[model samples]
Target chain A: MTIDALEQRLTDLAFDRPDAGRVTARVLSLARKRRRRAVARLGALAAATLLIAAAVVYFVPAADAVLADTPIAGDLLRSAGLTGAGNRVTAVGAVASSSGFRLQLVGAYADSTRTVLLLRANPAILPLGPPSLDPQLSDQFGRTYHVQSELTDSRTGQVIIEFEALAWPDALTGARIALKVTTLKRACASAPFCTDPVSSEPMVRGSWTLRATVGVDESTPLALPAPAHLGPATFNFTSVRSSLATIGIEMSVKGATFDDLQQRVADGRKGTPVFTIDLFAPNGDTATASYSLGEDQRGPLIQFLGYRFGPGNYRLHISYRGSDVDRLLTVP
Target chain B: MEAALTLSDAATAALTPDELCRRYAPSVCRFAGMIAGSSSDADDLAQDALLRAVRAIHSYDPSKGSPEAWLWRIVVNAGRDSARRRERTRWIVERLAFTAPRESESVEAAVLARLRDADLHAQLRLLPHRDKTLLALRYGVGLDTAEVGAAVGLSTDSTGKAIRRALARLRARLEVTRP
Candidate 1:
């Protein structure tokens, strides 16, 4: 018989084993045990991880939303609750740990923002001392301030969440406090552009302000003049695939030409002279469909990998350092 | 949609691990029975393949295509890995021998041969490792040209044309002494 015929006969023969069911069960049991062991091993490894030790941080819950968890300290807060702010916080802290613990809470309107007041009247019980600088408190501004903060010092102030920090002392002056809220960034979880996986490389992932416009238009071919810093700067491409979504881009520094950008990715991760990417919408503005790139290879011949974001109209802006073509891209 | 099976077949699919053995245990044994001396390796590989399928069921999107094709891919790859590992541990020095066996010692001489043909294995070993792999992916595991390209890092256009040339060569060699 032919080899194909013989193979078919063998497949048929496989179905004839009277004891096959009994055998498969034993194999399955063994597999289950193996998987369980793997899961337990992984769980043990995760428990040993130290990085997550103090990451309980989130955007400071909005003052409007903070009442759910705040304590009803200080009589001033109680009076506000009586008048209507549900839970009143005349002070942001309290006094006493364990022994002889008595909390005296008072609130009085002073600053524009309502405040939490906690007084450990029993000095023996150890009231919270003066507001000292919490060196660990970061001054980084996020996209939104869900301020989970307590201004222990009367001089507390918030700004418009700017790129630069407004001086603490500058924010406080007598009866008024300024919210120097500069635009800090918190990448929206549901933000249309947040599909990029969170990675720990110092290179920022999600989104950034573009120095120029870049995207697609109905008639014009993407006419990005070569970036000024084109010589041999490096760049990256990162993407993911699941469901039906697909996205990909090749970023390179300016002046190197499109051929140069393509060649860089073709040579893999190590091909250098840095570059960056910008995507624009139909109206010549940054679109929600943007992300950073990463490499999936080790050596010079590594494959160029990127996410496949289904189907849509898109354009790209290439940025390279120290060159005329650096920001030469303009959106249609 | 769940596949509706006959009473016996339905029972087989739904069978408990122990019952699954009672029903289809022989299929694995027979499948394993060919290349192996005893049923142990067959049982082991078959069990492993099935277990993997069961565990990966949650992640298996049926929309991709046939589950059987997917399962078989895993099975064949597993088998190849096992073979390579065993090759290492045993370290059998199979010195290259180009000559064919005498024509007189035909299929007539070995009716109960475990394998389909010894010549097939010998000629397969003669191929470069990459070609051998292409053969396994194309025929043994039954991947289409596009799928094979993805696995072997070849473009689809190249894989199909290359596989055709490679397979034709092997088929011709096998048919040389045939009627």
Candidate 2:
């Protein structure tokens, strides 16, 4: 028989349709359960934040100082547990080593907002200069956790990489961290003052993975009440939070549709972000925020993970496409 | 409720989960049953797909794809999972029936003509899982090349070639069995 005959035969195969009302109810019920779980997770996160704030305020005036003073790797090895506020700090680390490099999961201590991983490479075998890695960390359900920043020490042959844990699923207290080293080149080529030969050899590639359990440290959120109207959309910054590794903005929008924000971009209106929340430190360094809209939008949430924010007051500049938004506020 | 009144199935990306299930459940169930090789599991697979779609609604940007295509992708994933579960069960049952004559042989004897006329169905069962899914979505569910490609994670050009190859392969199989 011909393809038409085959198509007709396949189409003739009968299957009894399920009850629409029952299936609809099941789907809605599942969606409701998912939302409830999310709210519960948010409640837990808020409680955790309050606990961290209390500990920071009452237990340690020099908490930031104490944590920052310890070597980045050392602090990861010995950070306080979340059993109680102001509990004695103890060292708990998740370490994974591969043939080429050793990875250490330091607590998210430099600031509580960012999770840090320390990579120690053999300097002799592969000269550690400016090496880049493709980092993939996911929960059991295949949701991705993103990295925010990478800091390297050429002298120590150690790289401290930080990732954003704000968007990670609640069920996953621990995540699978997969790091694929894309390039490991000689230091001479990348160092500021270099007279050594520039080697044209292919860069070294290696991979390592670890299951990183999140510790109970958190950064205090500062409310930044700045609202700006752009085109058909209104951008609102509800709060700002910082940790050792990341700076985040809780952003919401009003008076916008999928066509105006996402569809035009998908239809090739240029690479314009629906919302661009930029963080500017006092030192003039700035990091742009990135966001992902879940299928249901309760407004938009923009977070800048992996952007290194040190101890200082800062300003946040909000913009839409290329135009400036009116409500620029000093970050609390 | 206002949006429900205004938008067509092809127009709006923001169709409610209830609407989606009501509109597409029949075809989705048929597609699932074809891929699953049993109609008994089709309802369960369709329910699973709808559940997954509703849970992931936040990530569904209409700008990237149509809602129907998105639902098809979920149906394919759910159907594959169902097939795997059934395979495991069948394997266990086969091992347990080592002492008994195969009941499947007797069942086939009763439905011999139906199987022969439904040569496409028998031939589809013998194809690779991916090819079977591609064909099921195309001919069984009446999806176009682009929709089939979207559901199966293939490009339109590749999908076209794959359907042609699958049709040729099925034709060859039917020819080989013809008396």
Cα TM-score per model: 0.26, 0.34
RMSD of 1: 23.2
Q: Which residue segments of model 2 deviate by more than 4 Å?
A: A15-22, A33-332, B1-13, B84-123, B172-179
lDDT of 1 by residue, A1-332 (tens): 44444333223332221145644644554434321111111223223211121111122212111122333333322212222222221232322222222223222222112122232222111111112311111222322112212222111111011011122332242222222211211212121222221243212212112111111111212333321222343232221111111122333322234434333322354454334444433233332222323333331111211121223343333333321111222322
- In model 1, where do residues sit more than 4 Å from their true spots? A1-19, A31-332, B1-29, B90-92, B96-179
For each candidate, the alpha-carbon lDDT, in order, equals 0.32, 0.50
Q: How close to the true structure is residue A15 of candidate 1, measured as C-alpha lDDT?
A: 20
Model 2, position A167: C-alpha lDDT score: 46
Candidate 1 shows a clash count of 82
Error of 2 at B133 (Å): 0.9
